[model samples]
Target chain A: MEENKKTCLHDKHVALGALMSPFGGFDMPIQYEGIIEEHNAVRNACGIFDVSHMGEVFISGPQADAYVNYIFTNDILSVEPGQCLYGMMLHEHGGTVDDLLVYKRNSNDYLLVINASNIDKDVAWIMKNAEGYDVVIDHRSDELGEIAVQGPLAEEIVQKVLGLSLSHLSFYTFGEFTIYGDKPAIISRTGYTGEDGFEIYTDHESTRRLWDELLAAGAKPCGLGCRDTLRFEVGLPLYGDELDDDITPVESGLSMFVKVDKPEFIGREAIIKQKEEGPKKKVVGLEILDRAIARHGAEVLDADDNVIGTVTTGYRGISVDKSIAMALIDARFAARDTQLKVRVRRKVFPAVVIAKKFYKKSYKK
Target chain B: MSKIYYAETHEYIRVEGNEGYVGITDYAQKALGNVVYVDMPEVGDEFEAGDDFGAIESVKAASDLICPASGEVVEVNDALVDNPRLINEDAMKNWIIKISISDEAELDDLMDLEAYEKYLESNPH
Candidate 1:
């Protein structure tokens, strides 16, 4: 078995008496204080997350724009420099390789931030597809660390504590700033949670120092546990769960990010065909009527007890106080207010298909 | 006076004559973080020794509750239904169910407080 990788903040999490667990091949803190406490903190106040395990790859060359457009589903030509667009890299068969963030530094330069677990797979896929293109791909995940400060107070705390004025940075936009005489770093006004926030990328040393200052400045130390809950409450999809080797973004209700009209690109044909005919399966929200929680891999059954689909993600809902889940089922049965049943362990729970966004977001537009 | 006995699975039963109150031990509650919900069996439900009864769910995972002795449940703890965190606050005091013991011989199979403490030390989460 491969040894689990540690983030630069691993020691700091241990010092804070956090409950550590393995996630995406990294030893990450699952919770600090408690899951409910940390989760509520992010919803009400500010919370800091060590997201250094995320992978970063820089692509630059004359053919960078053409190459990225060919491999990515989103239309990068729509965005100018200092902008970020969320999309997915797909297989020729339309299955997702990985969902990622593409930062448009310029027409000829782009930064692709990917999931930690798919770093190796994503790099290999990108390289193999770059045979004819003249782009230079540099995987710089090891050299950078990332921290996300998320909540309603994130903008205020980041500007006051980090001393970086972000009034000019709009949503999904980023800029370079040098901190403490260090190299220029990237800070973006984007996050997975349904709250206003900032994601900072810098050297490992600077990352640790910034974490210390945030904690001292009263930002609650959050872990991956609350991160998942916060994101789920907002209906954001996690890679392995919502989209996988067998599931396309179109089926996951993420067609907004896939530019099917693009003249030429990987998976364009399959995605367009699915879009025209409507995907056979689709992602939907479920509210369990019973107290039992429906979790991932739980089976979805129709009235006759025939399995119709499987749950992608589920929770007891810390903020909403209800048993809710996101499930991928036959498109015909994915309508709102549809009745369904989720087989959770020993019992079958009655559920109703509802809006996936269980909690409304409060982003600062 | 009630005599306390613990099962190897971390459930405890406090016996006073033929009636007993059953709950998870402190060690079990501590191991399973914040308790979000407890699935309790209905009153008048009968179980054999070592039978699966209900379940306890924490934020992370769910665990099945096992009956340590045979009995018919006389009362269920309704308080835990709305506030499962009571188990976390005090596991011993917040018993899950009250039952009239059918087989007193099963008590001989359980460990005393001293032996249960030793068992907890040997097995740590």
Candidate 2:
């Protein structure tokens, strides 16, 4: 295995006595104070996260828009500059490569924010698929640093601490700002936690200072542990767990982002066929009747102990206070009210098929 | 007076004659963070030594609770069903289960407090 990398805020996390672990090939902080505390803070008040490990690639050229549209599943033509769209990059076989957010800086320039674990693979895939497209694909995973300030009171904290105005920054939109008189930064009103938040992108030095500023301003410094729980509660898909090389976006219940009616794109034919015929497997939510959590890779079985599906992600919810899981199962058993059992360890837990969205998304739509 | 024996998996059994109160150690609870739920085995359920009887779930992860010695569960801590955080507050005071020892000789194979401390020192989490 290669040596794990550290983000610019590694020293800060250590000083805070955070529980550090290897995640996505980086020595990242899993928790600062505790996962439950940080999880509640993001749901109730405000929390700051060191998301510097996320990958960023810039695509710019005369044909950047066309190239990105061809590679991405969402319709980029509908969004204007400074707008963001969430979609997946799929292979010709309709399996997902990675789910990412694309920021339309302009007709010629676009910023693609990808998962940290998929940085190398995503960059290589983009470059390999850029054979005839007139575009410059620059992987900026290391040079740029990112932070997410999320929660209900996130706007208040960002406005008061950063001394920056975000009143006009609506959801899924970003704007460039000059911070501290000279440092230019990109602040986007977007997040993965299904809350009102902002993601700031800047240099490493600026990011370090900004983290300290957020702490001093009374925003809780959270880690990746609660980040997963918070995102899971609202049914947002994680990269490897929910969408992977073997899982297509259509089967992951993300077909809304896959524009089959759009004029020609990669995996369009396969995706269109899947949409017409319906995917063989579909993602659905299950509420376990027992307290045991049916974690990832746990088998979902039918009445006679036949394996019907597998769990993608599961959690004892902090906000909802219930044992819930999302599983990819046979499409025939994806309907609500269907009875299924999850094998957790040596025991099988009875669960009922429910809406995959355990908690309602509170995005400012 | 009760004699406490520790397992390498961090479970502790406080034995008083033929009865043993089984619970996780302070070290285990501290490592598990907030204890959200404790899946306890029902009374009269038999378990062999090192058998996984239940699980202790935290906000981030879940750990299986293994039996330290072969026994039959006589009582379970019903309080943990609603307030599992009691384990985090005080692991020893809030024992998870009470078992009637089926094999008292198994205690000889377990570690004492002194030996458990040494075992903990050799391994760091």
Q: Which candidate's lDDT is highest? A: 2
Q: Which ten residues in a row have the lowest lDDT in candidate 2 chain A?
A: A356-365
The estimated TM-scores of all candidates read: 0.95, 0.96
DockQ of 1: 0.46
lDDT of 2 by residue, B4-98 (tens): 99999999999998999999999999999999889899999999999998999988888999999999999999999988999999999999999
Flag regions of model 2 displaced more than 4 Å.
none
Residue-level lDDT of model 2, residues A1-365, one tens digit each, is: 79999999999999999999999999999999999999999988999999999999999999998999999999999989999999999999899999999999999799999999999999999999999999999988898899999999999888887798898988999998888679889899999898899999999989998899888988999999999999999999998898999889999999999998889788999998888899999999999998888889999998888999999999998888799999999999999999999998778989999987888878766
* Highest-scoring model, TM-score: 2
Lowest summed lDDT across 10 adjacent residues in model 1 chain A is found at A176-185
| Runs in model 1 lying further than 4 Å from the true structure | B42-51, B70-74, B99-109
Candidate whose DockQ is highest: 2
True contacts kept of each: 0.06, 0.82
The DockQ values of the predictions, listed in order, are 0.46, 0.77
